[model samples]
Each structure stands twice: as C-alpha cells, then as structure tokens.
Target: MSGVTLSNVVKKYGETQVIHGVELTVDPGEFCVFVGPSGCGKSTLLRMIAGLEETSAGEIRIGTRDVTRLDPAQRGVAMVFQTYALYPHMSVAENMGFGLKMNGHPKAEIREKVAKASSILHLDDYLHRKPKALSGGQRQRVAIGRAIVRGPEVFLFDEPLSNLDAELRVEMRVEIARLHREIGATMIYVTHDQVEAMTLADKIVVLRGGRVEQVGAPLDLYREPDNLFVAGFIGSPAMNLLPAHPTEGGIHVPALGPEVIACRPPGHVSELVAGFRPQSLRIGAGDTHSVEMTEALGGVSFIHCARDGQPKLVIETKGNHVERPGTDISVHVDPDEMFLFDKLTGHRLR
Candidate 1:
C-alpha cells in the first residue's frame, strides 16, 4: 500500500480558481474521505489527484513518486465513479479484466485476476452475467472489481454509492468498508453526505468554497469542531446556534431562557453564538417556546421548537413520543454541554 501526498495543490478554470491551495496526506492503507456541501470542490480535488484535472500549481505524490504531470493510467490510481460505467454487452468477467486485456496481458493472467477480484467482491456467481442482468449493487461491485484487478496503489471513489437506493446504499457501505479492510489499500472517497463520511472515513477532510476547514478523525471532528461551519455541517440535524450576548460571568441566551448560561467568554468578545446538539437538550416544564414539528423515527424523536425571533432548536429525545404543533414547551440546556462561538467571525470561542 502507498500513501498519497498533496502540497499546495491548486486548480483553476481560465481566470477563475475552484480549488485553492490544499495540503493533505493520506497515510498508507488509510481510508480518507473528502466531505462537504455541493459545489465545495471536493469532486474537483479528487479529480485532480486522479489526474483527470490538471493542477494549476503544486505537487501530487503517490508514496515517493511525483505524479503531478503524469497521466491517469501512469499515476497508478483507479477511479470508481457514481455511475457503473459498464459495457452492457460485456459479461462481469470481461468488464473486470478489460483494462488488463487492453494493456496486452495474457488470457490466463486476465482470467486469473478477474477470478480473484470476483471472489473478493462476492461477484463470482455473477461473472457470466452482463451488466444489464445484474442489480444496481452488483453492478457497482463489478465497477469496484474492475479497479481491484488493476492493483493500483490508490483507489479513488467519487460518490460511488450515490446511484443506489437507500437499502442498497447501506449494504454497499458495508461492502466497501469490508473491501478496504481486506485489501488494505490507500483509498480516497469523496461524498457530500456527512453520515457517510462519519461512518466510512479513518480521516475526513471537510471542505467549503474550495478551502479545507478541518481534517481529523470522524468523532474528533464531530466532538470538537474548529469553527461554526464544521459544527453546523458535520452533524445530521446540525448544531443549534443561538444568538447570545456576553455577560459578566457567563453568556445570556434568550432562546433557552432569561437566565445566563454559566460559561466563560473571552473578555474582548461582546456578541456570542451558543451551540447545542439536539441530544444535549431536554424538554422541561414552562411555556417559553412552541413546538413547530416532531419527527418520530421508531426508537428516537426530534422535536423542532420555535420562538418569536429566535433560531429554531431541535431537541432529540428517546422513544416514539410526539409533540403536537403549537404546543407550548420549555427547553433545558446544560451549561457544560454548551459550545460558545464568536458571532462576528463564526470562530469557536473554546
């Protein structure tokens, strides 16, 4: 397995720059995910690494070899795209071994490699079937198997599971995770879904507007975000950010109650933003807020509360309890669970 390194990597289209100077390293056998909102340049960066897009400035190295100017074929990287991109007329075995065949490998070698890949992806029984005969998930496995036969130093997946249904997507996530463990190859995956990034990545690169906001382990980014962007983007329902004012000993949060939350703020800061995850809050007694909606999903429920001018707050609770719309309620927040940020710059106040 070989690691991938990027130093001051940049991309541009004529006079407009899409990918800023990005510096990242994917350790050998690491599953690194690039996650962000749409049009955030996550796909652009992945294409640059795969040699599909030219780097305007900087260097890209796979292990020790600088692949900045190398062709995709020469970079020793295989990419699996959102679409299966399979030949309808060709059998699964043929699709898997096509790259090697075109490169002039012997028939025996091609068949051997295809068989091995098929076994690994559990596509051995479907080798004789054409792309049209297989299901979406099986076709995706064929696409993945094609990459495996090449034995590339790095595997690049650009939203490979986007085309699948919800059930298939979950199943394929497990398959991809298992494949990574069994092959132990350096893989770079790009997705806009934070849930996918959180579950699949060993390291996640969060990007926005062509710039990296943070890079760290999944839980690390979730528990300790660097700024407001990360704090809001990394979570499912997102962290609740309420407008606040700095007080003598703590911060005054109007959304929670009239009382000041017991948390220290920087002396220089005046305006503050307080963050609270839905799970950190609970429904208490009193009618300070009104329930806007309630989403009861089997074992858990999310209650959306609203006030006159305050930001909406989502309170996550256990069980199938549902609150009626316009029902008066009070939200209780623990001072220790609050995350303070500077309202002006959107930076965490720590």
Candidate 2:
C-alpha cells in the first residue's frame, strides 16, 4: 500500500490553465474521493495523478517516489474508468489476466493472479463468460478485477459507477466499499455525485472551477463548510442561501417579517446571506412563503417553496407531512443551526 501526494500541482492546455495550484495528500490505505460539478478539474487532477495527463508544473508522489514524469505504465497505480472498456471477445479470466500476459508473466502465474482477482470481485462464477454476456455491473466488476490483478499501490476510479443503473449503482457502491475494506489499498475516486463522495470517502476533496474548495471528512465539510460555495455544494437539496442585510440587533429578512434574526456576525457588516440546511427547517403556517412543489421519497418529502424576493428554498420533512403546492407555509430558522456568509465575498462569517 502507498500514499499519494500532490504539491502545488498545476495543469494547462496551452495558455488556458484548467487546474490551479493544488496541494493534497492521500494517506496510505485511505479512501479519498474528489467531488465537484462538471468541468471542475476533478477528472483532470485524477488523470494527472495516473500519469495519463501531464503536469504543466508541480510534483506528484506515489509513496516516496516522485512520479510526475513517469509513464502511465511505470506508475504503481490502476485506473477504473467510467466505461467498462472490456474487449467483447475476451472471457472474464482472459480479460483480467491480459495485462499480466502482455507483461510476460508465466501462464500459471497469470492464472493465479486472475483467480485471486476474480474471487475478490465475486467474478469467479462469470470467469468463463465474455463481456457481452454480462450485465453492466458485472462488466464493471470485471474491469475492477482487471485492475486488481495488477496489484497496484493505488487505485484510481474516475466515475466508475456512472454507467450503471440506479439499483446497480447502489449495489456497486456496496461492492466497492467491501473491496476497499478487504484490500485496504490507497484509493482515489473522482465523481460529480456528492452522495457518492459522502458515502465512500475517508476524506472528501470538494473542487470548483479548477480550485479545491475544501478537503475534509464528509460530515465535516457538510456541517462546517469553509465558504458559501462549499456550504451550498456539499449537501443534498443544498443549503438555502437567502439574501439579507445586517441590522442593529439582528439580520433583517423581509420574508420572515419585521422581527429581526439575532444571527448577525460580530462587528459591523452590511449585506449578508443566511444559510441553513433543508432538514433544519421546520414547517409552519404563514403567508410569507408558498410551496411550489413536493417530492416524496417514501419516508421523507422535500417541500420546494418560493419567497417573494428571495431564491427558492427546499425544506425536508417527513413524508406523512406532505404539503400541497401553492400552500401557504412558513419556515422557522434556528440561529444556532444557521450559517452566515458575506454576500459580497461569499466567505463564511464565524
């Protein structure tokens, strides 16, 4: 097992720079996930570490060895991509062992490695079948098994479950989690899905526009985002960011009536934004806001509401407490559970 490190990493395509100075370290045997919106450079950063993409500047280290200039094959890493990328004609056993075969390993050794990978991935039953005969999840497992046979120091997964169906994605998530526990290798996974990052990572690196927004444990980022972007992007349904202005005693919110909220930051400030999670909102009767939509997901429901001059807000509530669209409702905001950010700079206010 080996840890991965990037020091002041940068990437550029001609004069257009896609990745900013990035500093990160993945501890040995830790599962690290890179998550962001599309075009955020998460995939680019992953590729750079895998040696599939060149680094314009900075050093990448796999263990103690600097791999910044090494060839992809020379790096002690395995990559599982979004696509299965399996050869249709090859059986599972052949596909898993093909890398070893090409590397000039003995036939017996190749078979043993293939068998071990197959067992680890629960692919022993499908070894005789070709990729065409397998389901999407099964084929992905075969792709993973192929990586396993290489005995890589670090595993790189670039949205490996994006191709699977909803149910299959869930199953694959469990499978991958178990595989991580069983192997205990350093793994770096990149995905745009916050849910996946939340569930699968020992540390989550949140990125935005080629810059890393925050890096920490999932709940740490969720509960204590460094800025407004991290606050909004880390959670499902997102944190509700409402426009407001600082008052003498509290922050004044038009929608919440003449009564001021006593949640202003220390010192004098002008414009501010109030943030709170949807789950933190408690529904009540009022005429200030109106429900726009309701999404019931079996046990929980999300109430999408619209305030007169503010952005739309989603409130998470029990499924049994579903409110109809156009219903007049009010939400209570707890100052202790709320977050405050500077409206101008988008920086969080402590």
Candidate 3:
C-alpha cells in the first residue's frame, strides 16, 4: 500500500522546464531504478517524489495519499544520498539515532531502533566508532542504517554507490540487494551506471532529455529496445549500431560486406541502422575485417574490429583466442539476432 504513483508530473525553474509530464508507478515492496546519462533529470524526479522539490504541475501520491505540497518530513520516505552525510563527531550508533532523538523519542527507544538497524547492516561491532574511523563502505552502511531506523514507507537512493571504489561498489550492490529483500520496503534508486541499474532494479526507468525513454525489466529492455537510443544505451560496452540500407532480401550492411544482415522491416523505410550486441556476433578467420583491439577480461574477450575502416564493431569471444591486432577476420551475422531501426528517425523498425 506504500507504493508511489506520479501523474503527469512536471518541474520547472523560472520557465525552464526539466521534468515533463512523467507518469510512473512503483508497486509496494518493489525496487525501482531511474537510470540515464547525466543531465537527464533522474535525480530531479527522485527529489520530487521525496517532496524535497516542488512539482510545477501534476500530482504525486504515496500509498493513496496526495503529498504534492507536503514537507519532506511529512512524506513517509527516507532518502540516502551519494554522500554518507554522517556526523564525524558522533559514534555510529549516535549518528543512526540522531533523527529519532530530534523527533523527541525516548533514549531507550532510540537505542533499540539503532541496535536493530546496526544488526541489519552488520555495524554492531562498529557502533561505538565515529564516522572518521570507518571505511567508505562502512560509512555508506551507516547512512543506510540511519534511514532504516525511521522505518519509512519508501526509501530513496540517489546514486548511493557512486562514491565507493570499484570493489566496494560491487560489495555494496550485493548488500543493497540483500537489504531490499530483507526489509521489503518500496525503494526508488537513481544512478547513471547501467550495470548497477540492471542488477538492483526490479523495474528500470530510462530517462533522457527530461523525459522517459523506456521503462521495463532489465532483460526486457535489453532484448527489445524501442529505439536506437535504448538499444545503444542499455548494455555494457554498448550495442553496435552500423549504417545500413534496406534491400529486397534484407538490410545491406556495408560493414559486413555485400551479404545483408537479414531482418524483416516495415515498408517505407529504405535507409536503416542495423543493431547487434557483442555477444550476438561471431568472428571467423579472414582478412576482410581487421581486428582493431581486443579487451581480454578472463574467460571472455571482446574483439573490436572495423569493416573497411568503418565504425568499430565489438564481438564477444569465449575461451582463449590467438587473434592479435591486424588479424583479419570475417563476421557471421546471425539473422535472428539482428535489430533494424529507421536511420533518420532512430525508431525501431518492426
């Protein structure tokens, strides 16, 4: 019942509009992530939902209650920012219980809530340590613990993992996932990292230019992107987009030579863009295409190559490959894996 709903939400700053009529819904206990490149307004939308930012138009509802004009404290939501924002002068336990203490809760009650949150975050041993004494990951956990003590109906995370090191980011991703499962609170997270969005979200809202590009489950968006933008943006290393033209049999990709990458396209589209993921492409031994580079990341290697000096196409290869730079290779285009889009419009051609 604590799910969030937004109806044609809009935000403007002195006539400069940002969020434009965004309609979204997050089910209770669901983990929703807002993901996009920078300046896409993902963080602005999260702030609007948290009641920290005012809506220029439309309404926001949380658990059947309209909170469009309510104060942030009035909305049953807790937010954890990218920064820990913990008190360096106080112990971990003290920092966690500060909000409750301000709300005039009894000392015994505050201690109990802090203890429960600490146990959940595995901060029991470090409860007496100050913020300066903890690692980045531990400090982030303490920030999360502070939110947990409030028992908010919804949790807002604005790129909470961005501040951590690569290893710590991975570790915290697991921890956040576990926290969602354990607490089962409705959570909305915003991040620019597609990997984090794919791993943490039950549903992802992909935003662009202050508008929603697409919203769906991670694999759903991956397998069937609505446009060239979604296809190119959602995956790691990104999907390969090459200029092509529609022909009688299929789309002719100059990069792959005369043989067209087979795909059924709606009529009226002549020029098109052919899309393929790195994993979907296979390279054969040939000199027609030269290997530009190979990224060896254990067990799998991403082979980057170009056809006739065109845009580089990435092909994923499993196991050990002896292919070195300047090695000539040929691509085996899987017709079934091909995605076609309108060249000019960038819209997917069904």
CA-lDDT, candidates in order:
0.94, 0.91, 0.92
- Per-residue lDDT tens digits for candidate 3, residues 163-217, read 8999999999999999999999999999999999999999999999889989999
Identify the leading candidate in terms of TM-score. 1
| Candidate 2 lDDT over residue span 180-264, tens digit each | 9999999999999999999999999999999989999999999999899999899888988888788778787665555677854
lDDT string for model 1 (6-109, tens) is 99999999999998899999999999999999999999999999999999999999999999999999999999999999999999999999999999999999
Question: Which portions of model 3 show Cα errors greater than 4 Å?
Answer: none
TM-score of each: 0.99, 0.97, 0.98
lDDT of 1: 0.94
Q: How many steric overlaps does candidate 3 have?
A: 1
Better of 1 and 2 by lDDT: 1
lDDT of 2 at 320: 62
